[model samples]
Target: MESENVDMNIIPPQIAGGAMDAVEKRFFETEAEAKTFFENTSKRLLSVNEWGKYAGMSSFQLMDAHGIRADRTAEPGDFIRIDIPGPGTHAGMGYDWVRVKEIKELSNHEEQISYIIVQPCSHPMDKDGAIAHFFKDDATSTFIIRKFGLVVSAEEHGRNEIPNTDHGKFLDKSRNFVVGMAAKVGLSYPQWKNLVKGLLQN
Candidate 1:
């Protein structure tokens, strides 16, 4: 591929209201090596079901995260089904859902960047399901993978328009409260940190 100057800022800022960001990168001995690794990393990043494997390797057992695609491809409207612990283990209260809003890519020869942006959404199966949404609709989780020269980086940026709003039943609302507090206290950082590390891993 022929390399070109890509303006990464065009991806738009995912941060809003209260937010958190986690980034991890790995350097290769040569651009050839980075390109090879970038290809493998991209596959894992898009295979949402594999998220639990990375999260399990982290210090905290954040949740058994899983991605359920609405169609054959991982395009917009896909749903990410997360199996949280505690109350989340229950039938109606065990999951949170987010919808894939965008999947973008920009590449030339020496540089490549891909983005997967998701926002909190109502349950796909049941609009009024008892399940809770961890973040508000304005909240978004943007996952990025960039390969530039001999270096490759993975990033997770979360933006929450309102970190304190309640969006579901009492249990769902309580879950949201706990998640909001967790983000505020920095407990959610490790989960993202490990996730990005997993993406960059050889």
Candidate 2:
């Protein structure tokens, strides 16, 4: 399919419905611009799963189809990022890392796995400081609003690049596209930078 052209300068109506308004004030000159961008983005048919691939998890579904379990997938201390309260709401649209504290198999649901997670209260305002329980299937699948996946790092930037391929240019374009959509929803470029800095530091 041909990619839809979007105007990054306009904000969509959806921004007013979320936590993005907080940061939108800092980056966008006016709310109207943010609205225009978001309205255009809404016309695009990108699903949450396709968008989540950029955050990592490009091959999770394939791996799952082959019957791989969490024991062979993720390990403790590995950062698993998830979106709480999901999309199309006033909830914040940010991926917060919850490190795996423990991994256990479910007796009730065969082959299903769960992870005990500890969210780092890196910031003073973080209220989800307590350990939380997350299911591996819930985290990987995007049949619902929330999708948890592996965290992509700057270190893995060119690991999949083919020799002589202009992968960096394509990656930059992809990054800019997502950033544009994120900014419309209130995760301005500055806020995203801050969020990534926190992720890398922690």
Score every model by TM-score.
Answer: 0.80, 0.19
Residues forming the 10-long window of minimal summed lDDT in candidate 1: 57-66
lDDT of each: 0.67, 0.25
Q: Across residues 65-149, which tens digit of lDDT does each residue of candidate 1 receive?
A: 2433432336566677776554551223366666778877878755798888887666665655533455677777888898888
Q: lDDT for model 2, please.
A: 0.25
User: What C-alpha RMSD separates each model from the true structure?
Assistant: 4.6, 21.1
Model 2 lDDT per residue over 1-202, tens place: 1123422111212212122211111123455654343333222212212323333321111112122223234444444334432321111113323343433322221111122222221112233331121111112111101101211121110011111111223433344235334434443334333332322221
lDDT of 1: 0.67
Model 2 spans with C-alpha error above 4 angstroms: 1-51, 54-72, 81-95, 108-118, 121-202
Q: What is the lDDT of residue 192 in candidate 2?
A: 35
Model 1: residue 162 alpha-carbon error in angstroms: 3.1
